[model samples]
Target: MSGISRRKFLTCTLVGAGATALSLKTTDAFASAKLEGYPDSMGVLVDLGRCVGCRSCEAACNREQHLPAPAQSFDDPSVFDQTFHNGQKRRTDEQAYTVVNRYEPTATDQPVYRKSQCNHCNEPACLTSCFVNAYTKTSEGAVIYNPNICVGCRNCMIACPFNMPAYSYSSATNPVIKKCIFCYDTRLKNGLPPACVEICPQQVMTFGHRKELIEIAHERIKARPDRYIDHLYGENEVGGTSWMYLAPAPFEEVGFDTTMNNEPIISNVKDFLGTVPMVLAIWPALFTGFHLLATRKHDIEQHGDDHSAHKEEEKKS
Candidate 1:
């Protein structure tokens, strides 16, 4: 075949084979699949445009979650100036389930405040990557973790694209990943907004079903397009997060990582997972065939030599 024709033939064969395999695998997955978690679980959406950096939500979360008192009180504006090891500002930690970061927009006279917390992804990387099955995604759209089952491997921390989960590293004996649980055991189970959302003086945090929140966010943007950034940060990041954002300034200026692609975090790891089954199914047959081919000539020659020696021995006798 001509070079171009041969290339086309190879490309067609590979594409056809890949499509066939993918179809079969998807069919099998669907056949065995069952939905997970509580379907009616609730979530909170914080509009950055409305937050005034009052830190009321932070204080309420601290009190409700029974976290230790901050070195500076929630009312302390000094917390905004505090810097961590990398000159990065303090983020949510083991003691703080959520935090507000200030971003000064050059286009605006006043600084905008943005809250950072567990984004509660639709297909949480923490849930999928936890080897011990310590994480669960509830139907109400909360991604929660069971510390009792956690092995302290910190896979979830590494897997999280939002950098949400913080480890209790100070406690050597009982270290566990910690973050917001959407008030699952308390308010969420009872169908109430989380402490942070309930206590926001500015009505900055709106708690509801994730799907509804997306609509609400868009409506707010449409009604006041000039007042808010046109985009929702978490709408498609990591395959759509349960908690979404509507900000006045660009998300990057507000300390949000804008580099993340719209693809789910798990999608980045799919290539590795896809290789597992290919290696498992192909290795045995490939190695066995190689071993047979390698040993066949030696076995045939030994048998022929033995027959010749036997015949010579019989003639001498």
Candidate 2:
């Protein structure tokens, strides 16, 4: 066996360890519980047909999250016209975890309103993209953030398919990605409906287990086929979302992104994750065997040299 150099050995070990850690993170990120969903996962079902664009949900969310006041009050309808980056209307920001957007669907004189926030996906893209593992998917179906451990990479904001996360650019002291937390801290843990759901006077949002909510949505559609579209948005879009929607018009016409596939956003990175187990299983054995071989070779060389010196001394004696 050939002796290994210190640099080479360190390199091999470091490479193997790095690969193992990366693979494990990716695997854990993608490996959600069986993909059906967590047991008794809570969710919200939005019935767009029932929403009167009251903006009450927005007000409730703002108060519940205790976010900074917005430039336009939640009572202001002109907020609908406020444009931000990319000529897009205002999205969930530091001040608001949830916002409702207005759309005038074709063939309907009355405007259609849609709510926007973190979908709290079953396999959240933000969770997977976070190398620090700062994002977590709770059993109650909330996608939560931990700002302390966050490296401020802004990767989660980019990874999110919905573009839901917003950063506090003005905060020079400390900045973190912010999004809806499903009211996990204040309400979900205590088995209460979110502030937005509890406050909707029009009963536009229904809060319940994800499975039950899906059934209820379908039942509602079955009962009033004429009032709603045949499809259930968010039921299986991107491997399901805690918050879903029922629209009277086609989903795209009501400000929904219909282009997303049924597959989870994590599917984009699972390929790399599949290699994690392979590294974990192979790297240790490979490196350890190599280290032993090199060590044994060195021991044999030293022993041979010692034995030769002993023989010379004996002959001289």
Candidate 3:
């Protein structure tokens, strides 16, 4: 409306749509592809039954990552009783990459403690959503982030189903996302387990190749059916993840989202995005045909007016 004619406006709209589609083509390719992950990628298997809520893993992660000291010390048991707004469990934040949450299931008197962190999916939504390519899925099965190239879009946060990635809001400048990267730089790339896995006294986590861990988890469950649930969380959820869980209680009771289907989060998004390019391609030609028809009609009207004027001039002569 800002001094733009109808044809010019339509032309701009078509061009903009086409440009958007072109930009998203690369993202669609990443989202739609079947990513089975590296064959020898490392993974962690969390046994919920073994965790004692000792907070040693939290302390180890804090020391290993060199994060700032929390208001509540890692040694304090009061952290387990803490909850955020809406009575939600404490999640990973700028300060804490991993947090242990206590869940009291009605089925058992003993409370279940769940360690929350980045699951590092085989086909990560964070990697697909980041337009700037800030997120990367390592061949070692770690989902790492590059803050140097990050535009502070936080698209990864929304894309992650686990709600793991946290932004560093405390830094007024050069703030970046903070989350567990499986200790890629210090230990994982060197073929060592994470600090949390090593420091845990109860042996709550088992670090090994992803394929081998799956087999081990199934074996453990089969040997003790009464002690574990049949389902292995993260085995197929969101197209599988690097980290998996074996719990004695139902997953829902331990704060897992049970409604998610086996398909990756980006799969449906890619399906919708796939049509956008086709629509953009068709619209330009379709609207150009309309513009041509309108211009031809205008030309015909101008010719008719000239003919009328000529007839009037001839009559006057």
Leading candidate by TM-score:
1
- Cα lDDT tens digits for candidate 3, 1-317: 36557876677677667766765775667565776778988999999999999989889999999999988877788978887899998999998999999999876679999998999999899988999998888999999998899887899999999999999999898888889999999999999999999999999999999999999999999999998989899999999999999998999999999887888888878767776776687667767865765586577779999999999999999
- Which ranges of candidate 1 are over 4 A from the true structure? 1-41, 289-317
How well is each residue in 84-198 modelled by candidate 2, as lDDT tens digits? 8787877887888888998889856788888898999998889989999999999999999888988788999998989999887778978888889989999999999999999
Candidates sorted by lDDT, descending order? 3, 2, 1
Candidate 1 TM-score versus the reference:
0.80
The CA-based lDDT of model 3 is what?
Answer: 0.88
Model 1 residue 106 lDDT score? 78
What Cα-based lDDT does every candidate model obtain?
A: 0.81, 0.87, 0.88
Distance from true position, residue 32, model 3, in Å?
8.3
User: What count of clashes does model 1 give?
Assistant: 4
Candidate 2 scores a C-alpha RMSD against the true structure in Å of 6.0
